[model samples]
Target: MPLSEFDIIARYFAQATPGREDVVLGIGDDAALIDPPAGQQLVVAIDTLVAGVHFPLETDPYDIGWKALAVNLSDLAAMGAQPAWLTLALTLEHNDDDWLAAFSRGLADLAGEYGIQLVGGDTTRGPLTVTVQVAGYLPPGQALTRKGATPGDEIWVSGTLGDAALGLRIAQGQLQADDSVKATLCRRLNRPEPRLALGIALRDVASSCIDISDGLLADLGHLCAAADCGASLHCADLPLSSAARELMSADSGLGDLPLTGGDDYELCFTAAASRHGAIQSLATQLDCPLSCIGLVEAENDIHCHDPDGQIRNISGHGYRHFNESN
Candidate 1:
């Protein structure tokens, strides 16, 4: 027998992603209601998490819920939008009330902390999947885009790179790590925080911006393509977090993983050199450090510096749904 709509709601969708004022209507309704503040342009982005493809089958449901919304939030961050509302579409392999409860709890906690509203959603039985659409608002003419980067613009990135990728490696037992470190990296892999505040602060000043949902080299190629330019990135300047550095040092095989591995969600953006100080100030204000990793050169080609003096070229990536594999 099929599950009833209300049963699905109570079992899985109720309070899916917490509450906010903009959630004019929630679950159990024909449609969701949301209101963007006056004078703000709305920006929207959608992402999907597929079980056994996007995430492993043994993954925690709570972390899955957290990541589902977090990835969508990162899209808004790329556009420099303030999050407003979200709509979810969840498909379950089987209705498990315990799994549903945990998922809703995690989703709600993250949304509430971010002040984003869970306006509405639908649920059904199928191959496990979570699709989230997030809406955000920005003042007139203030959203960011990839096409703004230009030759001679400076490139910057927030936080460390590759930890999440490393986390996945650890989770899959491809890399051996102690329990404490393993837990930490896996958490980063599963529950990414979107860089929304830094994005908003950079809107007017940033030349172009994108979240690093893909690996750094690939995502940078995207910005370069949009701005009709190229860049030679400095390998030394890559802001590998302490955790990632330790993991890489422990395993020689992990050298290029940071450059090609996706799921970091940090913002890789560019701005004029003159705005460096302001960018620094904004970073301080947002409580997230920004690193000057490279300069935007002319559209010659996409190059990432090789620490061993062996240069490597990289291509474009944002998210490719059709690929079905990262």
Candidate 2:
């Protein structure tokens, strides 16, 4: 017999991760009762993943589960919050016990690593979709925002960019690579690491911050808009993985992926130039790559400066849901 909705929840979703004291009541409750940490602000974020919109249809169930929660966690990380609780609403076309087991394991593994508890959620029969909501905590008045950047601030991004876009190409059969390179790129697309530690460390350091979920240039455009300023990115200074560099070297057109490709999930932030040393120290301490790619400018436009001193104005934005072109 196929599993019923409640049975599925009990066998797969419930107790996926260890219990937490703050979770007064977890799965099986009508609604989760959470005790928020004292004297801290609450940060909540939600994201929905459809069968083929957020990820490819043929993608593994395990990856779907991980990515669903990871994307929501990325939002909390961008706000410089410490993740605590999560709830999932899962929709399925049909019940498959093996698929549920794999998906639950994937979700549980990441939640366990971060000490986050799955409190409560719902399951229903419908088209395949996953919606996850995560709640986090932050010290009073310490949350990072995209509005504090100044004209003279320097721009920094964590980790290399564009790998996920390349991974998508590989998955879609538009691009090909050797086995090792293929695995690396695909992993990046399927499993993005939220820069949680970096976000927390940056609360006092970054003048403003945002995550690079959309393309780097597009999200940076948002930061600029929030601060009512402009930016100049030095193309030569962009951080790229060896795989990306190798691929782009063969096809110069691929260069735009790092700038306009979404799904990097790294943090893009701005800080005063004087904080260079401090930022560098943080990079070393955290063992995460931090690249100074640009500078905030007084001009109200986004410009890219090539190594040869030529300037190109950029007017394009990142991925949009209703964009017929996307």
Candidate 3:
């Protein structure tokens, strides 16, 4: 007998959903019931992943499941929220029991790690697609936003950049990575860590914050726009993973990968110059490298300067949904 929707949920997702105190009612309910903590704000974010668009059609089901949630978590992290619960909407062409099991395992594993509960979701027969909506909590006034930046504030980014972009190139056959660096690059592309802890720690310290879903230049542009300011980025100051550096060393043309590529889920933030020491200490505590790549300006545009102080032309404005069609 073909498994029905209710059967699939019971066999796979029901047991996978974690228990949460704040969740009054979870999976199997018509709708989830959540009780937000008093005085804390609820932060919610949603992201959709379509096969062959956000990820390759041939990508592993487990990776797809993990990434589908990770990306939404990244958004909540940007707002300095503690992940609490999530709802998933899965669209599939066929109900392969094995594939569902692996994907559920991946999703459950990440959810377990973050103490997030799967509350509710929908299942439908369609093209392969996954949409995850996540909710988190943060103190009343501490949720970070992109509008708090000020002129003269310093800009910093967490973790390294460009590896995922390079990995995508390698996957597309547009570029090749040596075998030595292939695994690391591909892992970065497949499994991005949401900087949830770092975001929370920076809640009161950072003047403004955003996650690097779009490339640095593009995402930074958003930050700038929200703050009604411009920015000056030092190209050489961009923190590049060893793998990305090695790949770029061989192909100078790939230098813009870090600036223009997307999928590196790091946090980019601004803070007053006085917080330099404090920021450094936070980095040490988190064990996540932080780079002071630029400064916020009063203007409303973003400019990149090479090591010698010459302005460089930006090739692309990050990934746009309709770019390929146009």
lDDT of 3 by residue, 1-326 (tens): 87888888888888796798988888887998999889988899999999989998888888888999999999998999999999999898989998999899889989999999999899999999999999999988889998899999999999998988998888878887778798888888988999999999998899999999879988999999998999999999999988998999999899898998899999999999999999999999999899999999998899899999999997887887878721
What C-alpha lDDT values do all the predictions have?
A: 0.83, 0.91, 0.91
Q: How well does candidate 2 score on lDDT at residue 190?
A: 90
Model 2 per-residue lDDT tens digits across residues 157-179 = 99999999999999999998888
Greater TM-score among 1 and 3 belongs to 3
How do the residues 40-144 of candidate 1 rate in per-residue lDDT, one tens digit apiece?
Answer: 898999998999778888999899989999999999999999987888899888877788878887788789888777777788779999999988899998889
Segments of candidate 3 deviating more than 4 angstroms: none
lDDT against true structure, model 3 = 0.91
Q: Which runs of model 2 end up more than 4 angstroms from their true locations?
A: 313-316
**Using Cα atoms with residue i matched to residue i, what is each candidate's TM-score against the true structure?**
0.93, 0.98, 0.98
Residue pairs in candidate 1 whose N, alpha carbon or C atoms collide under 3 angstroms:
18-108
**Ten-residue segment with the worst summed lDDT in candidate 1?**
312-321
Shift in Å, residue 253, candidate 2? 1.5
lDDT of 3 at 242: 88
Error of 3 at 249 (Å): 0.6
Which of candidates 1 and 2 is the stronger one according to lDDT?
2
